[model samples]
Target: MSRPLKERKLLVVAVVSHAIVHICELSFPALQIMVAAEILHNPAAYQKLGFAYFVATLVFGAMALPAGFLVDRIGQRRVLILFLFGAAASMILVGTAQSYLMLVLSLGLMGGFIGLYHPAGASLLSLATRKQGAAMGIHGVGGNFGLAISPLLASGLAAWLGWRLAFAGLGLLPLFCGLWVLVDRSIKVELKAAPEDTDNLDRPDPKLFLLPLLVLFLMATLNGMCYRGFSAFLPAFFKLKIPAGTIPLVSGLVQAGSFTTLVLIAGMVSQFLGGKLADRFVKEKVFTAIFLLCAPFLFLLSRLEGIALLLSATAFAFLYFANQPVSNALLPNYVPRLMRGRLYGWFFFANFGAGSVMSWIAGTVAEKFSLAIIFEILAAIAALTGILGFLLVRVSRPDKKPEV
Candidate 1:
């Protein structure tokens, strides 16, 4: 097969895998209420279900590094195939779950399986494509689609079938993708040593790489805080600032749920553009500028009300998701080809693990102070991310790209 054909095939598999990762990630929340209502027979069981998902998410974040280790040993293709079959089985278990404990265990299994994607899939994208930023962006769009569709798809499936079938039905996508990959000989997943590793120019200096790697890790943690923290409370913040009766028909039409959907759709566009820009420009500078710009919109989001608040939020969401592709592309510059997967594991752990903490903090702050304060806090975090980005720009050599 031609190289370009192979790349395209690999991209398709990566994108589909990325989408299923998120579908599995978010589908539980969509179905949790139904699970509480139907199986537990208590609406108040929502909190318990939420806690179960929380533990499951911890499992998700915790598995990234080990998954990376597995990828480094065997190969991303094999690990991703495992993720597919494992996630499929877990989701099917969720469907068959007859008791509350059974449901929680199934969710944890689902988390563990889906958690394998980022390290494996992301490394595969970096290895397969020269346009790292564009590939990551396109891959991110798959995730955005998954996020956008999960609530509606899962809920609709439940409404039409039942919560059990909803989850089981969702599993069919990965199972199908897994089967396609298994039968298709064109998709390459084996790791080959890069020829460029023999060149000294391609290798980064260990001494100088440390500080920037640390900064990148810190910036990733903060970015995670901004992403998860903002998302966790955005609907509440919108409802609070722009109350149900605030904008007349607008209020009823674009309430919290619909507004979030709009933000996610906007994310799809911004992510693609962000990827293109990252490919065109100095990625670190582009990333830094995006994060810096986020602070102002976030600040505006905090202080404004009515339509102005909505516009600021839209701007913030645009800038927030735009950084994803740029940041994903940045790591290759600092890490050697062989270790990229492990670094990605650490990077996502910082992003998702540390990020999970911000939800609780934002909640407490909202209870003690106000929802608007959450934006202000996020604005500060964005500013810090920008500062780290600036430092990263100084350290990163943009003239060269990693070879795998």
Candidate 2:
């Protein structure tokens, strides 16, 4: 039977909400250049700001387990609403900050709220749809679009108005979205038990789960490190590479932001395509191929300059983000529906929490060695992730049913 209209509406709203969260979450990276110039005022001071960003990211990662636990106790809808409202308020607070300490505090608060999005949002989407790969792909498109637009929007607003107004304005989106979700009675929020409530469901075989879980965690951590490290410095890297006279239509700031936006746009297409591929093929195989392909692009990014640099970065981003939906889809195959929230939380803890540390490392490397080295390291990480993906393919048997 066809899905109900209400179910489709829930998917749209959930996707849109996920997009808003990404916009808020990614705004800082896009605005970092302007923030460095206007607020910090020292080239080296960006590393200090990077430290602050790291702290916020650490919180974003650290809170996932707790957020998952809360989702299990309360419900996905309630947790999602809290994430939207709380994240919006935190963005507004970030805009109003005047000092470095205030900015750090505001960002940390925003990270905490942003932390609630992945586990709850992913769980909600998983429960709402059976086409896990396609659903994750559609959901990922929302997030990728947000990632694509945030830089452009932040830069334009910063150029026309100011960075503060940019942050404050973006805050309104999630706030309004949260209110809409609150009153929408059609979206289901209660948790349901597994279909098979047998003893085997209650106590799953450790051998079936343990090895695959470790592989997933390792791959997630590596992917997170590469993603966070590369993104944290992409704006700065482009700013240094792009000549001041290349784009006269706007200021250098806007040009840099535009480049970042262009690179991320490739992710939108790749996410959708990757999701479709996951459904048609073995998800582990698709995941492994994407990671393997990404390494060469990272190496190319390290060597290229100007237009070549932009093209290479775009290719790299396409491969890097394509894995998102594949991994999200693969999770349900191994995990039971009822425990998905907490499992997703743990996965994100590796992805975001451990991965967030890359920002600090990238910053340090940029300060001491060179930004190019960071990409080289990322290339190695991507290759390693591919190896882990292959291992996952061997360990995760397709014939097994999900255990509670």
Candidate 3:
């Protein structure tokens, strides 16, 4: 093959591999409701399962900093391989768990492995291409593809073969992919941070990033909390809200899975559209608009039921996911290239770490009060994120002009 063609092919492999990582990352949430029903055997046990999920997600976010540092020391390719192998192993452990403690332990391990993906993958993509926004959007679309399909795939597997086998079956994809990565000599990509730019020698300020980092942190935290809380319980929410006999064609599991799929399908489209918008317009403005639009849909989610609930949830998911690529694309513009991994590390620390807390809180609230209340709170969080997005625009300026 030609050189450019070969390179493009390798990039596609990287992108698709990233997608598979996301599939594994999200498979738990997709299967959590059924797993709770089957294993815990109590309706209230979902809250406990939520806590377990939080532990895993907390580890996922907490480990990102170390993972980022490792990416800087080792090449992104090696880290990707580690993530694939470790994630596959974690999934198998989860599938074979015989008790709650084992399940949580396995999930926490899975989270740790999944944590390696974003910081390392994002840094690699940025280094691979100059059109950072477009690249991020494409990358985001890959993740959304995983997120979109995981629920449906997991649900179908759970129905056909049981949840344990569902995980075991899904685990094979990453196992094969990791082996391919281990042996693929044609795939030659390595990324490291560039040395600090010396052009600003006279203007050196060690604290230059403090304010921008703070804004980004708050923005990521709020957005993460909203996203994680809403998504973590969506299947259960649909299961509870959608009346019996509403759709006679399929089982309840299938209906809930279909609604989840619909929401993620909207998210997939939004990721692509958001990528284009991020590449074209001011990313901060795009983020602000998307978050602002999200609040109403979230509110509608709390109040609506049946088809209205489905539509509003889809709208909410679209806006929630649309923010991802824009926020990711915007981050590198503010930090040094060499520090991108660490920056993403801290960024996702807020994103998933804070989000983990929100998941637990949502579960507690659902146990104490009602699931509908969580959406109301999420709406408020979305509004706060919109305000922060505007603040981010005011306090932070990009280091370079837009690529396209």
RMSD of each: 4.0, 2.9, 2.5
- Candidates 1 and 3 compared by TM-score, better number: 3
For 230-293, candidate 3 gives per-residue lDDT tens digits of: 8788877888898756778677776777788778888888888888888788787898899999
Strongest candidate by lDDT: 2
Give candidate 2 regions above 4 Å deviation: 189-204, 399-404
Q: Report the lDDT tens digits of candidate 2 across residue range 196-294.
A: 322133345775667788898899999989888887788778887877657787887788889999999999999898888877887878889999998
Compose the digit string of candidate 1's lDDT tens values, residues 204-283: 56645676678888888898778766765665566556668654554332355455556666777788888888777777
**Between candidates 1 and 3, which one is better according to lDDT?**
3
TM-score of candidate 2 versus the correct structure, residues matched by position: 0.94
> What ranking of all candidate models by TM-score puts the best one first?
2, 3, 1
Query: lDDT value for candidate 1?
Result: 0.76
What local lDDT does model 2 show for residue 317?
Answer: 93
Q: Best by TM-score, which number?
A: 2
